[model samples]
Target: MTPLDKIRNFSIIAHIDHGKSTLADRLIQRTGGLSEREMSAQVLDNMDIEKERGITIKAQTVRLEWKGHVLNLMDTPGHVDFAYEVSRSLAACEGALLVVDAAQGVEAQTLANVYQSIEHDHEIIPVINKIDLPSAEPEKVKTEIEEIIGLDASNAVLSSAKSGIGIDEVLDAIVERIPAPKGDPDAPLKAMLVDSWYDPYLGVVILVRVIDGTIRKGQQVKFMATGTTHLIDRVGAFTPKLENLPDLGPGEIGFITAQIKEVAQARVGDTLTDAKKPAAEPLPGFKEVQPVVFCGLFPVDAADFEKLRESISKLRLNDASFSFEMETSAALGFGFRCGFLGLLHLEIIQERLMREYDLDLITTAPSVVYQIELTHGGGHIDLHNPADMPEPNKIETISEPWIQAVIYVPDEYLGSILKLCQDRRGIQQNLTYVGGRAQATYELPLNEVVFDFYDRLKSLSKGYASFDYEQIGYREGDLVKMGILVNEEPVDALSMIVHRSTAETRGRGMVERLKELIPRHMFKIPIQAAIGGKVIARETISALRKDVTAKCYGGDATRKRKLLDKQKKGKAKMREYGSVSIPQEAFIAALRMGDDA
Candidate 1:
């Protein structure tokens, strides 16, 4: 094992599309972690969805040897939705590489990540990436970093990870500048469970950082959080690929695999210690991540419901942040109501469920958790689904979650971006200019932002804006649950909680979109959006008419009238007895109206 002073553990932090993964690839290549035959783009991004979408969904760790020193590097996701992953990764490291795009300078997420590293008291080394681009402005980015993050950037390393420039400089900086992790080599074995995932060949692979003592094969270890013990079958480190080692010593990051069947046995942020001689106290655990968005995921085929349940359980083994519970919907049948960090997270989980498990799913419209206060001495209840809401008379006030958003945009799009925020009932907190860009902070209801605010903001800024937000608790608002009725029958899957002011417009949009999506039936189908018994918006799908008079071309007027009357009576009877069979495609499309609009 490498000596403590020669060990360096750091995480790569940056905004999305800002070269965090590229920089990691270059470092791995330069250190010869893998041979040319084994090398690939975004080597740390092992999932196909991650590679295809050009995003990192999970934090990846790799250990490398550079100039006789062991460097443990973690590549973290840059998207705000994955900020929990970033924070957890940071907690396992002593320093961070704050990668900033030379052309884009400091973005909202860059600032957010830098602040997280600061919270962790991490030694941050600024690296100006993408210098080979024609529009690269390294010096300006350095200035922006110093001004915004208040970090010394005068000696920042300028490099192009894509072109393999300044790779050695980065390695040297990490070795020389980042402090070595301090731990007692002879103490009881104590390690932090940085992450864990299910491996088909191996039940569960746990990534751990040894803060003190050693973790060895055949050693009995206990998870402090779960109070479960396991005999370590294998201890290894990632050379971008698994490499077995006899043991991991102090200040080293590595993985340990046991014949653990249950995923919950190895919890992220749990402390691991030798079962025979456990540490006096467990290490501080990571903060629990709360799900911000909730939606119902139903199987299109009722028979697949059990398969969906098993799939969700397996998925939870990989992703601890996602949560779900059994819920039965009137329209969608039996399904699971899953909670996620955000919309992107929800999308990824849904996509992974479909791709990995090969299950056909019908996802209900996404909703945010609302706090409902009951009248007169009644207790407050958390509302995850609009259909589960109590009667309006029993509720005192409905409070919706709000978020504090920070956006950075070019000066040209400042006016329009601000307008879009205002149109969503956002209250401007502050607006300031930095060079040719503007930074605006606003507090907006989370429900509004969750629907389509991000998409609208991107379009308004022509995809030049960067946004980051954090939930700022909850506030009482004039929120009402809007229910959709097709042929006077309520659709629980189509219900949503909306602010009173925007209910009509939102409801109108939904009903109009549903009219176009739902196929025409033999009888007219009336779709209405309502708040309680009051209808806010309505649309009708005209029935397909069959001319009964075509056979009687020259019949008498009274005879034609009599035939028409009979036909009208038959149509009225059909309308009363007939039910609208909304296709699965219609539900999916109508639910996405917020995104398309």
Candidate 2:
């Protein structure tokens, strides 16, 4: 068994593109975990999407030996959408390496992660990365970290992962500064499943951090959250690759495959203890994730419905944060309503479904849950889909979700950033200056920022600003459900809930966009946007009529007039009997009209 005092468990947290993976690669190389020939960029980032996008999606754990000490390091995703993943990773570690880009200083996401690590009560070792860049400002960034995060920067390590500079200092700091995992080895087995994924050959493979006692292969284990028990078939450690370990003791991080069939049975943050000698209470800080943004995902072809379901099942095995249920739409046919942590989470899931499963999908406009109070009785319901909203006459009041957004930007762009926030209906709560940069906080509607707020903020700040947000519960708002009609028929997929003041303007924009996207039919197609029974905006696509006169050029005037009259009658009858066929692209365009200027 590995001595508990010799094991140091830690995670690397940072903003996107701050070189967490690169630092991890260097650490592994320095420890002889992998040979120089086997080393590659982002060795821990095994996913192709992660490598291509230069971001970590899932947290990866690797074990390294340095100076006779076992260091287990977890590399976490940097995006706000994957913050929950980072939180889970932190729960498994006793310490954290808060890596910040030297030139960029501290970003919005960096502050968010630093607070999370502090909440976990982990020992935080600050590190300034990318010192090789010509724009690198390690001293400035060190001051920023101290001024912004309230952490002492005197001992913060400065390193460039790309140049192999100060890498030895980082490794030495891990061994000397970070505390070794503390737990009683003789106590009942207690382990936290920080991450889990489904393997076709192994079923559900779980990565767990042993908090106390010991766990071994062939031992019966019970999940404290679900009270489900299964016998472990195999136990191993990640030497960057899965290397079989006879048993995992306290302070060790390893994988366990119990031959479980259901993905839901093995949940992240769930505690695993000996079934025969179960702990009296589960570990603290365990909570199920709640999805914030939701949208309908429909296969473009109905025949791919089963395939979509299977693909989602596989994806769910890896991403437990996302949830879905079978849902059907009148206009878009059968689909699943999937819930995501944020917009990026939604996009990543959709991209994975297409790239991994090769399924064509049509995603409806995303929406947030709204609490509607009944006018007749004081009864209320949470409305997720705008199409499912009750009639306006039956609703007395509506409350939409709100969030507390924290933005970090340079002082020069503060005005533009504030203006963008004000336009999104944000109410400024606090503003402060940190190391020549402005850190602003605002309370805004979650729906307002979930769609296009980040993109707009980046544009206004010239990509110098970083933003993060947390839900602040629902607040009463004047919200109205806006609907779009094609050929005067309501399209369920094109419905959305908007603030009352912007309802008319948003409706007008929707119809105007639809007019441009919808192909002209043989008959005139009328596109309209309505709130309840009141039409706020309208647009028309004139019919694509063929000239009957072109074929009758040689005919007399009387004959031409008679032919034209007959043609007009025929066109009128066609308009009455025909229905417009709206293409898939038109629906996509209409749903995303909110992003248009």
Clashes of each: 0, 0
Regions more than 4 Å wrong, model 1: 551-557, 595-597
Tens digits of per-residue lDDT for model 2, 1-597: 799889999999888889889999999999998998999999989888889988888878999998889999998888888777688899899899999999888888888988999998988999999998999999999888888899999999989999999999998898888888888889999999988887889998899999899999899999999988999999998878779999999999989999987677888889999999989999887888888899999999999999999999889887778899999988888999999999988988999999999999999878988899999796899888889998888999999999999998999999988988887889999999987789999999998887778888888889888889888898999999998888878989888999989888888888888888888878888899898899999999998887877877665799888878987888788888988888898887676665463
The residue-by-residue lDDT of candidate 1 on 412-494, one tens digit each, is: 99998998888788999999988899999999998888877888888888899999998889999999999999999999899
Q: Over 4 Å off in model 2, which ranges?
A: 375-379, 546-572
lDDT of 2 at 508: 87
**Which is the leading candidate under TM-score?**
1
CA error at residue 147 for candidate 2, angstroms: 0.8
Q: What does the lDDT read for residue 25 in candidate 2?
A: 94
Q: What's the lDDT for residue 400 in model 2?
A: 93
| lDDT scores in order | 0.90, 0.89
